[model samples]
Target: SAGSLQELLHVDIKVLMAGSTLRKVKSRSWKKQRHFRLLEDGLTIWYKSRWAGKGHSTFSVTELEMVREGHQSEVLLSIAEEFPAALCFTLVFHGRQGNLDLVAESPEEAQAWIQGVRKLIHRAQTMDEKERLDQWVWDWFQKADKNKDGKMNFKEVRKLLKMMNIEMNEEHAFHLFTMADKSGTGSLEIEQFVHFYKILTQRDEVWKVFQDYSGDGEKLMLEELDNFLRIEQQTGERSAQHAQELIERYEPSETGAMTLDGFQMYLCSQDGSIFKPEHQGLYQDMSQPLSHYFISSSHNTYLLEDQLRGHSSLEAYIKALKRGCRCVEVDSWDGNDGEPVVYHGHTLTSKILFRDIMSTLKEYAFKASDFPVILSLENHCGVEQQTVMAQHLRQILGDTLLTTLVDGQVPLQLPSPQVKIYAVGTDSFSLLLVYIPTFILYLCACRLNAHLLIASGHLIPTNSSKEKEKCGAENCPMASFALFSPLLQKSKSKLSRELSDLVVYCKSVHFHGFEHSRLHAKCYEMSSFSESKAKKLAKESGRDFVQYNTRQLSRIYPSGFRTDSSNYNPQDMWSVGCQIVALNFQTAGLEMDLNDGLFRQNNCCGYVLKPEFMTDGNAQFSPEKPDERQGYRPLRLSIQVISGQQLPKVNQKEGSIVDPLVRVEIYGVPQDQAKDETSHINNNGFNPVWNETLNFVITTPELALVRFVVEDYDKASRNDFIGQFTLPFKCIQAGYRHIHLLSRDGTAIPPSSLFVNISISELS
Candidate 1:
């Protein structure tokens, strides 16, 4: 039966079950025996019920998590509390906030189901560096082979690099093409293409980095290797052992020294490299309340340029998702083609079809990360278009879209293994219960809860019973709804019964002041503030903001006045533990660069667990109030600016030389600080050694970032930026380090680096 179903669905699926009775968690009705197929993209279950005829439901692999057979009590309790009726051998599948449990014939069948699902998941999770590189190269090759000739010419190769936002000189492009074309046929075959891609993505700087420590430019003895690993690699006491092991593993002879190839192998290994392993853990604690972590987000994610006149395209979504942005905004309006469109409202920006945007999202949603994507939908469409928009989203997103509460009941407390009830706030009604039909909830306000709601308009209060009756009976329809209670500051205000039923977990609250937020409900209270307002609030009450954000979700968006779609420095908000720091995805500036760098950690999964201090409700951490902590140690940083190699010339004109200078800047909460060495005048940009040591004392090293800036000095004008590299101070390794430079757009410039010696000490 599963084989037949696989052929029908046109997917390569391994059969997990030939027949089984499945019960809908929401309805508690058992359907007739059906076949289950595990597809590459998702799981498909085909069944027939008395009320509903033959049908098949497909759940995306990204949305499904397996719960082992014996470890199903907590899941069962979470589901039973929501849906009263259930049977044994039920395999529970968890989404963002919803759970679906399918009943199997026996525990053996359930274990088989779990094992099958996990096998596919394991394959997806174990994508190593080489596998990822291969996938990346293949995706680009497919895009570049517009003619579908299985080969790319020099022109196509150049276009591919440009489309990827990589800048390359024409001469360099020609040279690369010539080298990749092994047969001198002026085209790169698939193998040749992969060879070229490896060259572009490979880290050849390992040779140069090794030479910095070896001093002889050829090999490194055991002591030299140990010192390099201890100081530059930050390997601590095990540096000597690791060095000996590396030499034993990679050295060709008993010379007790490592060559260039040996060093490269060590750098590319799992235990020795900066790159995270492919199966790196996705999260620290999945059971923690969603409000406790910072989620990477993008503002005006559909536009490619200024908010006033930028081009709106599906490419924006792809780019943002690939960069580990979990939350993306979509501004929707009714289009002339009877379909909803997405664009910046009240601006000269162009529009793209909503269906096209959905398609792009489906393809690229989990490419970079497998976290839940929050679609911040700003709806400005008529009722008809609104229904159409909902239809498109449901059809395209399929089961990946979260549409219901996790346990079927409004959570009375924070999520814990025991389902323990935690006090929300001092408010009388900590948890409100109401009943409304799903369709009615959709019709009343498309703004789903934080997970998946359609926002028709700004939520307002209904004062009188007559007003409430009118709001519900006419504007909104209500039946039976189980939703999270809304926490409103105003004591006397009333809301429509239908509207109140839709506010499940994320309650929209207008930010009044810091004092109001401290006393508010923890996980249930949600607030959105403009970037400027948030920044001002953080500046005035940084500690309060940090404490408030510890247990609540705060969304900081771009200021309304930014017509050019410029972004604010997200680090300022991150310093206070603001969860959602939304930025303009199109703007490439220091703010975006910093955003990219911050999210680059934690496996680039877009959701990073807040620091222990930030998540502890009572612990206080403020950049301005460092002395408040009694045992805090100041971080002293020492950087020796050695030299630059193969630095790009600012002016491309012949006979022009760059007067290179190195500027080391430290950015943190107390204030921005910078120290620059004198520019080496008249020394061409090639390999100028300054030998100048710059030192800085940092109070908040955790929130600080060190920036290495290379500039071309000019006598009469502002110096031009040749390259820059910025990273969080905690991620910085000690000792002799080579800092690879990045272009203004943040793409790595191959083989370009600054050699430096860095040491960090804790001040007494």
Candidate 2:
């Protein structure tokens, strides 16, 4: 809790020290002036009506995702004419929480609140293990100070312990409390309570590991630290240099030796974080064809709940895109006034205007990712409404809409989404739309190298060969490509030619057999399969599926049977090299967890390069038969579940403490798939110790995803989920690492983590 983090804590929210009144804009019609103030802890914002005597409502700092100034949000933009843009801002939260739109009386006031909240968010996000512990202890101390007198006595401390998921023996707890009461005062202040917290959370597991490595009990010598790094952590030739760096960074005092505190700090530091640091940046080759990467996509993106009755919203698209969903689906149906509405076409679902969806898409397309965002228009509209949709897309998306073919011609290889290409406006975009009844057509000025080849109906290599020759003809007057898919053709009578041309990279097609795809599929052609169908293909013809995806794209969507908006196991699709495994982003579960974890890398730009075996065109790889093929050696992974730190309590039942257990699950090839569980630590969600070692033999290490879940054990009914974290096997760092848990909605639950020792070695 020292240095820059400490400074950041104090500087954050300082601007909000003096309270101010701001207009809380709910919608255009509902606006109320409220007095908003930051709490003394600088981690919560308390707001209330100016005259009401009602208890104040508060928002936690950790819940905040970001603050946007100058009418960036839809809510802020809604009342843009009413309020000056400089005075308007939005507070965006993590997960599915609704955004808070506010307008200050003055521009200075708005800027102050915006910057202060941002700093506070940065402080929370940057806190390290030790800093987090300190902050957590302080927050608990405040919570347990029932009298609000800024101090706590033994009785209050006891209550705090219960709230923290500890059912310790009374005598022992009092003993530790007395030890921290150094001032001889009957009550302990915030600092004293923090000291007591340190005593309670002393890591014996860390100490024993340190004792095994350190020559002396007090400090680990340099050579001994190096040995631990090489042997336990499996570090390579840079172990000595890495050990020196650790000593310099974490050692309490530069005495040329690492103390136990330093050793623990090193283990919890970024250098020792469970996720490999290299993968945290733009490390992957983004230049590869988009099909070569597993793209994060959303299914039924506008629906916030059950597809049949859920509300449709632009907020849903905003949230998904901000969370790095690269591809978003909009089921377009004709609405009143020639507008196209997006929703479940045949259901009683609510609708959002297609133009509004496009507006939101344009605003947030590159917010989290610069890579191209594919608008999978499930067009169910007639020609009039479809043309309107086309106009809105061209007007709203304008320059972002990549309308021309690569090299002014159909390419032998699909263009990468990150490819640098230019096809400026020739003002013929609108002309491309009104020409045909069911076809979308657009051709850039034929000035580049190769001739463009396209077909009006479901175009593929073998089937659309005649259209290819016609499209290659000089001054080919008409421009149209594939709009026909099983899903769209079944419903829609007409779709705009311009809207279909807007669909780049993801040229949807009805998937035939693998043999058919191998013979007729082109790089740009993509197939959408329901989860059931994809799963069957993966099980029956896994190798052929993998091979077909190497040059082409495949999207696996949820089955229509999932009426409740549930998700299928995306791993089934991903195992067969299916790139866009779209899930119901609104639904939070293991499926979403895996999706988040898989794409939670490479700056989370919504693409993870598929494994070499899956992407290499000539390589022979089978998802079902991983053992028989490959140069990669099998891995023996050993994970020691050490202790949990401040786990969350589910069920919200008063006076109920959690009986938490840690479960390590592996998802990948069927042979490598397994789950290992530790016995539950009863009545303790705070700092529970298991020290149980779970081991697994992973045949396909490249494909395996490791998920660590902590659950509240219930003997009477099903166990409740507390928190989880998932990441690829290759991103894992060996030796002692902390798995910081995330809430069910994939938001960070700070200080809630499992301290574990991970060791990965090649299996004999």
Q: TM-score each candidate.
A: 0.62, 0.89
What lDDT, from 0 to 1, does candidate 1 have? 0.64
Please, what is the whole-model Cα lDDT of each candidate in the order they appear? 0.64, 0.80
Q: What would the TM-score be for candidate 1 when compared with the true structure?
A: 0.62
lDDT of 2: 0.80
Instruction: Tell me, by TM-score, which candidate is best.
Output: 2
Write the residue-wise lDDT of candidate 1 on 488-539 in tens digits. 2222222333324443445555565777767645455567777888888888
For candidate 2, write residues 481-506 as lDDT tens digits: 44444443443334445555465555
- Off by more than 4 A, model 2: 1-15, 28-33, 49-54, 81-87, 105-108, 422-492, 503-505, 651-654
